[model samples]
Target: MSNQDSEPEIDNSDLEGNSRSQSSFGDAIEDQEDELGSSESGEQKSVTSDSSEDEEQNEIIRTGAMIQQSKGRKINKNERITPPFITKYELARVIGTRALQISKNSPIYVDPKDSIDPITIAEQEFNENKIPFIIRRYLPNGNFEDWELQELERLD
Candidate 1:
């Protein structure tokens, strides 16, 4: 027999295996897509329900008087201090700034005692309330209140 007449048989097992894998991969993707679609629909339904409940509560709140009544009558500005006393942060800033001024040969508010240190002198001046400075405290609403150094309540 001639080589042309006696041709070798081709193996298709590898092709069959590849086809099976491709079909399984496609099935997995379809299943995932179906699961995702169902989950998204469930989430949409839950969101709608939650929003409807919120709308009902909002309608009730809108119908009722939502104005908050003040607990106490407003006091005159001169009657009481808003913060009552200077904060530790404010005290530190004042002392540091005054010490800088003292170091620069600025006029000292109080006489230096045993310690001629600028920081010590600034602390003494602060304690004696001799600094003629206004502490401007600002609120979040762009409003500010100015407190005189002597006007603040002292811890000591």
Candidate 2:
């Protein structure tokens, strides 16, 4: 009458609709073996093999003798460079961050208006293209280029 009554009832009715098929290690083992070549024994092995397979599976082989041959693409140094326009996503991110700063009492680089909304001020600065900032562009080769805001036009 004490412990039984104190226990809360659990409702699993919602979980019935969310039931999923049982997952197996077949996919994981196949993926690992494909990425990492079979052991020195020269026969295909499962995930239950010795610790050597496990260690090899953990290490990523980008350039080595053990590197697995894949039909994937190689790095193209002459890949098309990004256009000289600021992407919409980057513009949104910068404006959102600047708006937050303005809301927190940060001084606006542009003139203030009768209304004190930070988002509005940020939008105004963006529309007038007066935001003195740098647009950092990341290349696929792990190098980055900093572009002046004036030099790059807004895509939208």
Candidate 3:
């Protein structure tokens, strides 16, 4: 067969059928909106009541009131400096990072042993608490705290 016979047929009837169906669907939607008492202005009515708006405003006001209450409370300079406790995950991360640094020829804070293993050296430094590292703690509420390792020792 020739290339012309091999080519797919372009049917205008299918296109007409689809356009008719889409117009019918649109008309059905317009009829539904009219039955539902939609206005001529075409602006949709608010599904929520005035009470919902009042509740939202009350929530905002309540949060603001809490902030105002907090402002009245006396601030303790000493209490604000309290350090958070270190977690196991943080300890592992610090040790692993330090070990990687040591492997890359970073200066060791602790006495270097005969062994060349970076992990062993890191463990030694951590155990002796000789590494001058800061413990950073993050809370789920986006609050973060940083403290010197000395603070961890003090807390212990």
Candidate 4:
């Protein structure tokens, strides 16, 4: 086939349709305003009380007053939130007190040179960059900061 036969045919109606509405922008705008005014002036009937009352009664009570908060990343049971690596300051605190304690009421026996405390090792690893570990403690002490050399908190 020749190039002329290959070319797509344009619809003649589209060209005529566009030409029909080819009025000037100002004329088109003025025509729209005139149509609006004619519709408004055509009817002077006042709104009936019954129609207005029904509209007010039929008002939809939408339960959409709640603030739409942006969604965050979802957490699944298969997923876990890893805590930020402990810093040097945090490590020292855990090793010297929390990890060292054998009993809450009893005094702690801690020897940094030969200590097998998981918390101490974890803390040291976190702060000093020793090695990654999976630590497990049956009883976790929650009183390291309570009685430390730092004396950070004042208990009255």
Candidate 5:
């Protein structure tokens, strides 16, 4: 094979087009600068140092005011603190964990009575709200609220 076959061909028209595009891009930037009031020294007129400092102070004051307002606000009692009821997934997790503890000879909260099954005893303890466990429900903002097992309404 020849060297020409191995090497990629450069089109002169493509090179000319690229050079024209580059020049046009530079021209567009210059036009934008001109429209934005660029001085003869190529310096753009922006907010003065004193004005910028005043803006920063105003921003800080606004932020402080917002924080103060938030602090002064009282929590509404009508707002649901904990979930209305325990979710099936949460109940399953709690039951599974309690059952495991029971299997490992951990003290059960409720009397097993005739039922010797660990899961059955765990369910009874959960129904009677005998478990002293807190469920940490997390919010989308990474904040979490610890709700006691007794605090949540149980569904049959």
Candidate 6:
């Protein structure tokens, strides 16, 4: 009764998770010259739980920088066999809006033909538009025909 009552009633699960998440690779860290428990003189500290945020804030990936890729996964039917590949910087530059701001109805409109593919329209939009904007295809992951970067193909 004495030891149990005296013990702190803190749950450390969340604290442990927070500590473990920060140890993720490729995170941004700004160092300070102040003593322990001291705040920076004129800098606002930024903090968050998302691991990917670290790469965006600090320096961008230069040439020959290491990038994380899924290594041991076997080729599965669910996975996209031929997904579009663009440079990271090029993708960022082309997509004026982030994934959040892109709307499903924004691109890939109905075609004049009886049956048309969405990917063709998407490809069309991406190729024709002078000002780069986010072009998201609504088609499921594997079948790119439903969602494409080109405007019109044989089906279109």
- For 45-152, candidate 1 gives per-residue lDDT tens digits of 533321134334211111112233223232345754467687776777777878888899988868796776999999999888777665655443334455666777
Q: Give the per-residue lDDT digits (tens) of candidate 5, residues 28-77.
A: 55466675665645775585431133334211101011233322432233
Q: Which stretches of candidate 2 lie over 4 Å from their true place?
A: 1-80
Give the TM-score comparing model 6 with the true structure, all chains together: 0.19
TM-scores of all predicted structures: 0.48, 0.46, 0.44, 0.18, 0.47, 0.19
When summed lDDT is taken over every stretch of 10 residues in candidate 4, the lowest stretch is 137-146
lDDT of 4 by residue, 1-156 (tens): 898899998879856644543465424655777888998999776864311343442212111122322232223324433232333443454454444343243233333457656575444443443322212111122111111122222122
Model 1 residue 156 CA deviation (Å) reads 5.3
- Of candidate 3, the 10-residue stretch with the lowest lDDT total is 57-66
lDDT of 6 by residue, 20-99 (tens): 33434423222222332265556668885322343342212112222332222223335544345444543443443322
**In candidate 5, residue 61 scores what lDDT?**
9
Cα-lDDT of candidate 5: 0.61
Computed on alpha carbons, the lDDT of every model, listed in order, comes to: 0.62, 0.59, 0.57, 0.37, 0.61, 0.35
RMSD of 3: 17.2
Candidate 5 to truth, TM: 0.47
Give RMSD to native, each candidate: 21.0, 17.0, 17.2, 25.9, 18.0, 16.0
Clashing pairs in 3: none
lDDT of 2 by residue, 1-156 (tens): 898799998899967654443225324555566556645446765665322443432211121122322322332334536567777777776678768878999767788678688888988887887666555454444444445556668765
Report the lDDT tens digits of candidate 3 across residue range 40-107.
55677678432233334211101111233323432232544434455556666767877988999988
